[model samples]
Target: MSPTLRSIVCGVLGLTLSAAGSTAAAAATTIAGEAAPACVQYTAGWRYTFVSNGCDTVQQVTVEYRDGTAVPCRTAAPGETVTFPGYGTSGNEVLGVVLCGTTPA
Candidate 1:
C-alpha cells in the first residue's frame, strides 16, 4: 500500500478504537477539485489528523477558532499525515474549523 493510504488507514483504525463508545466514528474527509487532489481531515478527541491523498503538492493545515481566530498548524507532504491537538478538554465547548491548503510541489 502507498504511504498515504497506510497513514490514513492507521488513523482511521486509531480513531475507531479510541471512539468505540461514541455514537459516531471519526472518518476522513477529502477535499477535491483542487490542482492537487490530496488531503483528508478527521478529528478524534483532542487530536485532529490530516492525510495527503498522493498529490505532488504539500498540504498546509490551519485551525480557525470560533472567535474568528486562526492558528497555523503543521504541513504534510503528499501521502503523509499531520496531526494537530485540539484546544481545551472534551467537556469544554470548543469550536474550530480546520482549513487545508495546498502548495506547489
Candidate 2:
C-alpha cells in the first residue's frame, strides 16, 4: 500500500480501537477548533456541528493517521456540507488535518 493510505488506515484503526474503551489513553481523545477545522476526521462519527465556510469552494484534503496512513478527500465546492461515514473509529484525541487546493494551477 502507498505510504499515505497506510498512514490513514493506521491512524483510523488506532482511534477506533481507543474510542471503544482504551483506559491507557484517556487524554488522547481530541476535537479542536471552530468553523470547520479542515481535515478533521469523523473517526467514530460523533454528532459534531460546525459553521460551513467557503461554500462552493473546491478543495482537496489529506489526512495522516497515527500509524502514517494518508487519506485523501476533496470537496466539489467551498462551504459544502459533506458527510463522510466510517471516517474512523473515534477513540482518542485527533492529531491534526492538512488541507490543499483541489485544482491545479
Candidate 3:
C-alpha cells in the first residue's frame, strides 16, 4: 500500500479505535492494540479482530462484524490475517472490512 493510503487507513483506524473505546471497555478489551498493514481504520480491541488488504489497492476486503463480535477468523488467509486478528470465534468482538478479492477479498 502507498504511504498515503497507509496514512489514511491509520487515520480512519484511529477514529474507529476512539469510537470502539467505550464498547471495548464494556467488553473488557479497552482498545489495547492496532493491527498492521498499518494504514486503515480496521481496528479492534483485545477481544476483537479487524482485517484489510493494504497491498491490494483495488482489492477491497469486507470483514463481517456483528454487534462488534469476533467472527471466528481462522478462515483468514495469510495476507488476510494481518490488518486484523481474525483468528476465529473467541466470544470476543471482531471488527474489520474487506473489499475486492473474490474470496476474503
Candidate 4:
C-alpha cells in the first residue's frame, strides 16, 4: 500500500482502538447501586432510619466510635430509628453506623 493510505488506515485503527478502550474503562469505573439508608443529624447525635423495602425487618444496628470502639448492636424493627450520641468536643466526633437486615446497595 501507498504510504499515505497506510498512514490513514493506521490512524483510523488507532482511533477505533482508543475509543473502545475508553468505553470499557468508563463502564468499569462507573459505580451505581441502590440508595443508602437515610440518616439525619440531631442536637445530641445522629439518627439512622432503616427501611425494609420488601426485605426482613432490621434486626440489628451498630455504632462505631472514633476511638475504635463500637457500641453493642441493638435490635431495630423494620422502619425503626436508632440514635448514636456524639463524642469529643462540640463537633469533632466521628460515628459510623451499619445496619443489619438492610437492603443491599
What lDDT score belongs to each candidate, Candidate 1 first? 0.47, 0.42, 0.47, 0.48
Clashes of each: 0, 25, 24, 0
Query: What is the overall TM-score of model 2 with all chains considered together?
Result: 0.33
What C-alpha RMSD separates each model from the true structure? 16.3, 13.7, 16.3, 14.8
- Cα RMSD of predicted structure 2: 13.7
Cα lDDT of model 2 by residue, 1-105, tens digit: 999999999999999888665542322332222323543333324342222335345544433345543333434355454433223455423344445433331
**Per-residue lDDT over 1-105 for candidate 1, one digit per residue giving the tens place of the 0 to 100 score:** 999999999999999877763422211222222232324444535444333434466655554444443333456676776554554454432243344544432
User: In terms of TM-score, how similar is model 1 to the real structure?
Assistant: 0.37
lDDT digits (tens) for residues 52-82 of candidate 4 = 2222444455544557533434455555555
List TM-scores for all candidates, in order. Answer: 0.37, 0.33, 0.22, 0.36
Q: With candidate 2 superimposed using the best TM-score fit, by how many Å does residue 34's alpha carbon deviate from the native? A: 18
Q: Candidate 4, clashing residue pairs?
A: none
Stretches of candidate 2 off by over 4 Å are 1-56, 85-93, 101-105
lDDT of 4 at 72: 39
The residue-by-residue lDDT of candidate 3 on 1-105, one tens digit each, is 999999999999999998797555433422223333444346666544555444544333444555654322222344454444443455544544533222221
- Report the candidate with higher TM-score, 1 versus 3: 1
Q: For model 1, state the Cα shift of residue 26 in Å.
A: 29
